[model samples]
Target: MALPPNSETERGVYLRNVFYNTHPTEVFSTWPKLIVEDYAVVGRLINLYSFIEINLRRLVESWTDADLLPKGRIKDLPLGRVEELAQTVLLWPEANLFALKKMAELRSLRNLVAHFGMMRFPDDDAFLFIAKSEADYKKQTGEQSVEDVMLIAVLDGPALPRLVQELEGMAQWLATVTAQILKQKADAEADVSKS
Candidate 1:
């Protein structure tokens, strides 16, 4: 599936850098490296979310044949609003809806990391979602508390690669769904013209 050109060039560059620089061996080698790798993972996750959101907006605009951003607008519309419009107007297919719902779950995690800055352990919801074992958490962080478990989980643990894989899969699924939607729309328009 061919996605439209990325609107966030700087973000794309930063994501590429983060991917190239982050390594599992380095992350496990030292505490400092672990922290940096954690930051990189969170940063990359945010960038992927932004990329998906932007493409979703573009897809909606193209399907509607109207500019989401007009001359009178002081600022662009929010992603939630755009998503609502897409659901209502475009009527996304079931597969697309499932994919978007999964993305929304990740969006919550992204918000927690982005807003809270990982100064403390993630909340119960995030902790459970990441699903780190107590024994493993104790061995890794030297503490048995859930807070410590969450701290390690968010920073450098199994959650990192799992979240990355989930996001990558979602991005690919969205691209394929978007391509199918566009093709269907084009075919419908052609059929109307024939009539």
Candidate 2:
């Protein structure tokens, strides 16, 4: 695809292509055939989380460049701190709340999955972070036991793809918002010059 004229839009497009073109599903699908099902699940989850984190940083940096956010606030801040600022600045369209919550949950899950071995699946923690209730978790996991929850049946299944889709949506939203803010800034500058 040709890059969008807007830099922020181009960044969003690039992020989506990176995530979808990587084909995480195909990469992890082969693992189970190798009898490393746990690795498949863990690996996919970590990969998804990492991609989202990277895109979030990119989006925040774009916001800073457009003057939509104060540069000093994000300087040297951790992802969590950047996310906190995002909640306030990106709260338009109400549905953004769901996106923010999902990102936060992914961050928490990423920390646990990346640091801890798969021997201890943080099912309870995952449930708390992402699910509204045990029933909701079960619904998402198809009533699978917590022990069976991290199986490829779930990770390589619908949930992973849905997450990728959500990330793409968020990238588009961020790009659109960034473009609007930058246009506004440009207009203000032009007005000042005319004056």
Candidate 3:
């Protein structure tokens, strides 16, 4: 379900309350308040990204039962490799390929957010640079020139909250997938033991 329209306002109020609760004596200036709120959202995105990474790592661990590798090797694996392993090693059904595809998309966005700095051009605005959607590429097909290939898209103030909501939904979906895979692994092991 989508968040209520006032969710952003609600989040701002909650942050303000928490800040005041912690540093009761400090007065919040408007500029610093905005900075704090902005960073708080960024922190949230990074935290959710970490959650996705952990779940992806768990899926990778669950895929293999053998202890041939060193202890902590899986922990050292990067997100992209983990994702690739999950896609290749997991026994996903034809109907569930959508999850893997969505994962690939998420992986790209995660990389962009994790690695790139948020840039604010003085004449324009502050925005998160993301990949152009497939639909965007399609719209430019045949008319595309050497300079026409659009790789970056922008997300400014109004869209960040919605992006957070979408990421939360994705995290939930991935958790469900990981749980199902782990359960299947356990069931298979149990069946082998019973035989």
**Model 1 poorest 10 in a row by lDDT:** 120-129
Give the alpha carbon lDDT tens digit for every residue of 84-191 in model 2: 766776655678767776667555445544543223112211111112234434544557455423321112233433565565566566556656766776787789
Q: Which residue pairs overlap in candidate 3's backbone?
A: none
lDDT of 1: 0.55
TM-score of 2: 0.45
Best first by lDDT, ranked: 3, 1, 2
Off by over 4 Å in 1: 1-34, 66-75, 119-156, 179-195
TM-score of 1: 0.50
Q: Candidate 3 versus the native: TM-score?
A: 0.54
Estimate candidate 3's alpha-carbon lDDT, on a 0 to 1 scale. 0.57
Q: What ranges in model 3 sit over 4 Å off?
A: 1-34, 66-72, 91-96, 108-125, 128-154
Among all windows of 10 consecutive residues in model 2, the one with the lowest summed lDDT is 121-130
| RMSD per model, one decimal | 14.2, 14.9, 12.7
Residue range 3-101, candidate 1, lDDT tens digits: 112235564454434434546344334313225666677788888888778767766766555343333322276766666655565456787777776
